[model samples]
Target: MISEKERNVFEGMAIPQILLSYNNGKIKIELVSDSFCNMTEIDRDSIQNNVAELVHPDDLASLSVCFLKFVEEHSNLDVMFRVLDKKRNCYILIHGTGLWQLMEDGTEMILFYFDDTRRIQNSIRHIYSCLKEKDPKAEYNDAVTGLPNLKYMRRFADEKLNSFGACITQQVLIYIGVKSMRSYNDRYGYDKGDALMLLIAKTIKEEFPSSFCGRAVEDHFVIMDEFYGYENVINKINSINQKIKKNAYGITEGIRAGAYVVNPEIKAMNAFDHVRQALKDIGKDMNVICRFYSDERDGELLTERHIIESFEEAMEKKMIRVFYHPIICTKTLKIYAIEALARWIDPLRGMISPGEFIPVLSRYHLLYKLDLYMVEQVCREFEVRKKSGLPLIPVTVNISAQDFDYVDVPEKLRKILEKYGIDSDNIIVEITEQDIAKGTDSFKKQLCSIRENGYRLWIDDFGSGYSSLNVLGQYDIDRIKFDMAFLRHIDDNNGKNRRIMKAIVNMCRELEIHTLAEGVETESQLEFLQEIECELAQGFYFSYPKPIEETKKC
Candidate 1:
């Protein structure tokens, strides 16, 4: 047993302390400090000699092992367990450290100091809060919006998903991205941009109420909550956008959201990926507000992943081949220029459609590589045709807006042409009208440099977007390729499209910008192009895009 002085010393300490005595194989509680009783809300009379009763039931086995080890090794006890708070009917995590003394009467005395883990955690949180206040860009929270960020969302998602197996309630993971946010930031200032983000974050929290909300990235927010139904979630998103528009100081761009219902097959992070995929399905159309994940979209996402993974290998093996679709001079019925198109012939999947892979690459900004590769291949074909004495027509290779960001387009094309000992006239640069409509200074400079370097520029997919007339007036384009939509809807609306097509061709002719009508399939379409005096035409009515060798024959 502990002597009177030692017992008084242990009890007088400010920290919660307990004294126990061991004799033979049994344990006995000798004394308890006032602090220990106050912390645990257990009276000394209530505990009596049964101190083990105060330990949590779940912690009893671990506590026994800790005690046994301490006694056997004559080591200081340092262990963590839960102490039952009888008054509160709860358990508190406690870190207990003790030193054992061999008593004079063949008894062992143990003195323990207990620290409440909750108190320590609270102190740590206080320090962290001070630090976060000093530095806005703290971990786990977005500096701009003061909301939990992607890292925090990931951890929260894991915890929620771990508990989902036992619960029947289905949760929805939502990803929302503000459309035209960059333009908004450019028009307003970055401070206003940050304010916009904060407003959206606060709005999302208010709208979802019970959901876990976070900033996924710039102008994008994520939310997870119990999914009542699609209508409920969509209405909430609409409400969020309406609130944002009203409060955002004349912000015009609305938020687009994608939702995924949580399922057992996917992990936590993948839920975000699925919702992002659903958002991508909405594309650039500002009218769409919300989209939900579907199995078809998931399959497309898988295909996109496969395409991204296999792109480098495909390029190495030259599986990404250039097929030339011949554009014909309508008057002479002869090939005027061949538009170089990428055709990925996977050994396993055979031919993959451009519709499947082009947008995927464009989304990921991988189109620059494919575009440059197409240019190089076209130059090589020029070389082959020269060596074989086959007729070489100028080849128009499509360039995406992303290509200019990746490389100096004019310089890159100059080097590729020089590499093949080919002239710039042998290759024409085709940029979509929509891309030209972006009209970034750098993009405009690149286009000017291309033309100044003797490479012709053709505006592809003209009249596809709203900025067709504006594009023609601003840029010095060599040719205008009408978008297929006009031809597809030619006879609709009592020949309204036919009249528009005729007027556009007439305008192009007057501007000295040569015109081409693509997707000309039937005899009527060809006759319409001929009647409108369209300078060039290309579509299935002539020939499909064929390999370089087959194109030479045409």
Candidate 2:
């Protein structure tokens, strides 16, 4: 039992604390601090002997579990729960840390340090004050669209989920991401952007009248509604998109949605996360406007998360290695150039496919790190080849559209070359036709700057997108690598694909822009490329992408 001096010291402390004695699975609050009474505005008489009555009913099970776990393991207890504040007529979030000991009287005593600092933080106070100044409902409503904000939506969903036992109902969370909103804002203005957002908000509200809607963030909206089958929800989303397009003041951008069926077993916020994961999986594919979350997608999301989290460590530990795929001369069967591909061999997960991690990194705008690392590794490989008396050939490193946004590609590449004492001529910069289609002035300037710094420019995956011909006319590129799709479908349409491929190669040859046909896996393919006078060919016919050490032997 706590002595009179110990009890006095605990009661006199400023930090909110509670002393509880557990006997026969029943807990009795033995003592409470003045700070606890002041913070919660609860009288000592109400909770001093009955602490369970003060805890939120919804959180009681979790609190009981925490105590039970502590009792079994004799471990420090940490839990977050809501406590009733009688004066405010609301519950305050509390983080409690408790230590337990066996008292001399055979009772288990637990001293819990309660922290409600989140309620009194300056940031929370400032937000509340600012919102109150704006309007009476400012805390719950978004200022621009007059729709419920994210906080309000979360609370609404939580309340609905919390009452699931009383009224069990199937529900779904939908995340709508506004496409091309940034470009729209740039084209118009912020006022016009706000107007566009208001139009979308109004459309969603009208389409799903009974649903709880909110503006999650800039250009993102969320909805929680009764599950009314997948087809019904998809059709409603289509209607919303159509209505917004018609009324959006010449804004052609549409919304992409991801939906998740709400599981009462999960927290309200996690439902939002799952829905966003579905949306992220949709990516930039125009064909997929709506995607539903599934167990497989969730597993993929977890894997992507692991890849992202492990990237920096992978780089530091030299797990990301550069592999070279030789681009061969179609006529002489000699190596003309080699494409540097990044291969990640995680020690724990083993070989992680580029198909898996590359897209994840690209989506997260982390390709710049990988691209830069590849450049440095290529320079180091050049040094290695020189030392080994091996032939030096141009190494092509791919730069993603996202890379230019994160770093000055030309400047960084120049430095990496200088650091390894390698000439820029030995390195080639490759970009996709789809990247050129973006036509951003900054990207265009970056491309020019790259060539000006003495690195050869090549366009990879030509003919994969519609802008291939247009890109050739606009940019002064040294080489155009035909996309593997063209070769993959060469026999399609009764020789139409072969005719198109031949014409493109011949046109490039006439224009003095060198041409390379990739994915040439057969002698027939190679003979066709040689017939068209294509300058180079690269595929398994010559060599698969191999480790640097293995490539030296080739």
Candidate 3:
């Protein structure tokens, strides 16, 4: 019942206006935020009208739900739309918020007015840019699935739950990731791999619209959903599995969904982090994928935080000590070498495992400092050995994959060696098998540079994670240290694993590469490895890893 004077008043009010009548589904708008008023040569009124026509098909449902929730919770009637024109000439964002009034007859009428639109287009541009930049080798993202990364997921959850008004720490979460993305990427090119990722993303968004889905790794995706949660999403996932089984790719490609639920007070890495460890609890039973993280386990999370902080402090205070563990020649039964093990004896907590803290250091790019400290420590120790006229046993120190990529690593090693007057053969640099696999060319070049200077290079954890068949050709190295697990598994009569160890050793033998085994804890294991003619070995069976005093006592 807007009179001509009322219409004119609305138009003259100097605001972009829309009057929606509860009576007859009527919508009338006054052109205020138009090209004439824009002062920027933009047709604002047409842009506002076109938003209703060009709402995102993907976002419309969620936007509608958001509006329903918004209206039900509060009377603030503002909304923004990023939409395209009728001809799809250009896109515009319409910021429309509403005002509500209760009439004398107790009828509620809502009126919407346009808000600021300048920043809307910028936000859209940034989002699309992020989606467009494709990185295939990115260890952080599931390259085959466009999902949130572990870093992204953890930070996202931590930030959200850290907020005061947010949900509690016990909300249920589920991590859904693709199984064996590498094989798929290998069988097909990256383009098809990316298509699979898009498929997973779409499937997840279509199935659980409210849940947060993010990629955690090259093959893992994390999902956070409500509880009633497992039942809410599990059935649909099963059907998706069945469909994938029957599809053109057939059963070759499998989608795995793991669920973890937390209490309302639980924080999510955008809801994915809370579920990851929970699902991991039931290790191999892939079918019963849903599990909830217990609240009692806050200790683990707190401990991780403590380790990061304490390790940083310990490094600064030089509380981290390098103790040499002797590596004896099996044939000679004499100490010709040793490994420099980084040990942190915290003031209050005592010894800290390098295993626990090393990953965090790598994650935070703190390995550089640790590497430098190791170099310094080894050099000082080498000087003492020389002055004391002790046997110049070559001391091996680890160099992480990241450090190998550093052009300065070899030079850094050389400086330390020269400064301490340590013989080139007295320092052996050990690079991991994974390091060579990840950075083959750079690693090979770096190792070769160091080796050419009369320094020995050894591949640490040889029969371990991501150990490649072409390791010798992949990187220049003189020796491969067997993983300690090999000894235990072999002793347990672990057939395939034991054979893999033999094959690795045999290959090294043919290449004239020396072989060493770590963690030889038992007599049988040592005798068994020695029977294979292993040249060098280290472990508690021969001699326990000890500090200098402990070594003398032995």
Number of the top-ranking candidate, with TM-score as the measure: 2
In candidate 1, the residue pairs with backbone N, CA or C atoms under 3 Å apart (3 or more residues apart, or in different chains) clash, namely: none
Q: Can you tell me which runs of candidate 3 are displaced by over 4 Å?
A: 1-291, 385-390, 491-507
Q: What is candidate 1's CA lDDT for residue 326? A: 88
> What is the lDDT, from 0 to 100, of the residue 150 in candidate 1?
78
| TM-score result, candidate 1 | 0.60
Query: lDDT winner among the candidates?
Result: 2
Query: Candidate 3 lDDT, tens digit per residue, 71-94?
Result: 567557545454454454664455
TM-score of each model, in listed order:
0.60, 0.61, 0.54
Rank ordering of all candidates by lDDT, starting from the highest: 2, 1, 3
In candidate 2, what are the lDDT values of residues 304-334, reduced to their tens digit? 9899999999998889999889988888888
TM for candidate 2 is: 0.61
In order, what lDDT does every prediction score?
0.84, 0.84, 0.66
- Candidate 2 has its poorest 10 consecutive residues by lDDT at 160-169
Count clashing pairs, candidate 2. 0
